[model samples]
Target: MAAELMRETWSGEVSVVTIGAAKSEGGTRSAMVKIGGQKTLPFLFAEGAIPHKPVIALEIWDIAPLDWPEESTKPYGQSIKDPLAWAQMCVKEFKAQLLCVRLQGAHPDFGNKSAQQEAEFIKALLKKVDVPLIIKGCGDDEKDNQVLAVCAEAAKGERCLIGSAVQDNYKTLVAAVLADGHNIIAESPIDINIAKQLNILISDMGLPLERIVIDPTIGALGYGLEYAYSIMERARLAALSGDKTVASPFICFIGQEAWRAKEAKVGSADQGIMWEVVTACALIQAGGDILVMRHPKAVEKVNKYIEELFIPR
Candidate 1:
């Protein structure tokens, strides 16, 4: 007799959130990307469903990223100076499915560029690329509100995901994203309770649960990565147990955190590459639905891993 197979069942599933709007949906993009809607863990195809493939979003900055380590910036060549070119290269050359435009220039500590300048830059970038975008702020609450509000209007109806809204500074960004018809990323430190609470706060503002993606702040390998992994695992389990407050899709800033680690910053090529790849792989297994990565090679490896995991046996 054949051996019996055992499987676990889940009552709740991750919420499905669509990021871009096509022409038929009143937006100019050629396509759209849908994430989440999984009935099982990362890849347990035999047990449940994996409705959408997790996506890789290449991160690009509005201004030249002089602080970026040479290992990370070496791939982009001259496109670093031009946001449009860099975005195009990511989609065309690197075959990135999505692009994340980080508005670092607007930060007071950075260039301190005006919100209007940032808005125009977004408009120009939207015209240059047809792929969906994730508009990130410069980590400054006050400036993010100003810059993102204008960007929300500039990219109106594009259906971009705008955020990094934390428990304390989410009001202004949340209000603007709601008004502009864009999705929001509810960012929280690597704590399950805080993660759930932030989601509650955002939803209480009248934003539908389907329009939010929870970002439990990522911590790279050897740098509290295990803590992040456990938090995500627990959060996923909570969501699976039918907790609506924690059921939204998860997004990890993998590249940002991974590169911040000393091993990835100054180590040899082998160590740097492996560090990023390992960090990203762990996060994927831990239940990351969207990964914002920096290195093209690391992205390639993670994409390959995702493909293999999603393949039915």
Candidate 2:
């Protein structure tokens, strides 16, 4: 008799989350996209159904990213000078499933913009694009709470994903999202236990697991990325294996890390040739559900790899 192939079976429940609010469903966007309606492990299409496919958001900065490598950013040319035009191009050209406008420059020293200025831009953004909007803050605990609250209200009833809710300021930000009736991303710094803990804390505020997305923090390729990868993998595995509190879908800032790493930033055949390509592909394979990427080229390339891997024969 021939030996039989063995496979593990899981008898546990998994959570499915729909991130964006559709227009007919009551938002400005024509449609909404959610990443995790998976009933099995990532990319296990044959094992169970994946109700919502992975969605990619093109990242735009409220201010030009001073840190991005010129080579990595050259494609956008001078369009980075205007957030509105850049956003228009991202939707009309590259086909962004969603748009994330980072208010990184809204800091007084950065953009010298007021809360009013930030809200103006956000309201302008909602008017400019019909895609489900994700409004992110500049990672400041106190400032983000104030700014994001104003922002959530500005995009009120759009049901956008409004957040950057951290442990330090989750209460303030969470209150804002609830008040505005928006979904949010609860960002924790790459610790599985901490991620779960934050989830519980936010859940305690009465936001269902379905209403929030988890950011586990990505480490760039060849830059301590393995630890980030392992944490995400384990988190997914634990979720599939019956960790109810942690079963919310995961998000990774792939482009942010890709460019943050030395290799992806380099512009030479000797240093950066194919590095972004290699790194982005690996993250997708490592249980990353939503990848926030920068370059159009990398997004197109890695998306192909994802299709080949995630879709069943």
Candidate 3:
């Protein structure tokens, strides 16, 4: 006889919250992407519901990545030398629906480009790709505030997703986003409580609940991944069980985590590439709505997992 199914009955409820805007909807994308609507645990297809398939976003940076390992860059080649060309390839070749370009050179030490400089680079990338764009900072609180606010105004009406608003700079960032009119990715450093707090802080800034996206930070497998999974799972549970603050769409910085960790994507052939795939699949299984990953293998593996788990009603 076939083994009994391991799935158990679940009882929960969650509001449907969609992120991103379309060109017709006033953004510059062909279609808007939506995530975060669950009535039960991850992929309880019979019980829980998935409104939109999880989205994959390819990450790029403004300047040539001086720090990326050769293995990853070898695949990118001369394309990496030009940000616009790189963004073009990520969307055209990789079929990435979202293009996230981090302003790495804008950091105080690294070129310290002003808001106008960031805006020009962003506009250039925007012209290169038709997909929705996500702009991130170099994690400097004060500089992030100054640049992001100006960026918000510069990208106005296009409805780009401006991000990484943390607690210390939430007031300035949130107010600017509100006035300039754009969506946000509220950021927290791998803590559930901190994640919820950032969401609340943004909401308190008068930003509507639907326009917010949460990034709780990620640590790849064998590098505090267990903690990330537990925290993500718990957040999903709370959101589905009707905790409004935790219901926002969650985004994961998969590349940052997977590449930095020694286990899978970084090590030698003896290290086994399968581990990286497993690590990525584990994150999808752990309730990640959007996996912002760099390696094509990781995206392929995660895409397969989503395909297997999503069964029609």
Q: Report the number of the highest-TM-score candidate.
A: 1
Clashing pairs in 2: none
Q: Quick one: RMSD of model 1?
A: 1.1
- Whichever of 1 and 2 has more lDDT, that candidate is 1
Evaluate model 1: give its lDDT: 0.90
The per-residue C-alpha lDDT of model 2 at residue 243 equals 81
Q: What is the TM-score of each candidate against the true structure?
A: 0.97, 0.93, 0.90
Better structure of 2 and 3 per lDDT:
2
Error of 1 at 182 (Å): 0.6
lDDT of each: 0.90, 0.77, 0.75
Best-to-worst ranking by lDDT: 1, 2, 3
User: Taking the tens digit of each residue's C-alpha lDDT, what string does model 1 give over 1-313?
Assistant: 9999999899999899999899998888889999999888878888788899888899999999978778888899988898889999999999988899999999988899999999999999888999999999999988898899999999999999999889999989889889889999999888899889989999999898889999988898999999989999998888887888899998999888888889887758756667788988998898898899999999999999998987778
Candidate 2 off by > 4 Å:
267-273
- Cα lDDT tens digits, model 3, 1-313, are 9997775444544444444466666666665666777667777776656677777788888889887656556556799989898888887777887877788888988889998898787767666778877788878888888888887777766666778888767888788778867778888888889989988889987998777888878777778878888888898888776788888777788776666666654557423235556666777778777777776655667677778777564
Top candidate, metric lDDT: 1
Q: Report the poorest 10 consecutive residues by lDDT, candidate 3.
A: 264-273
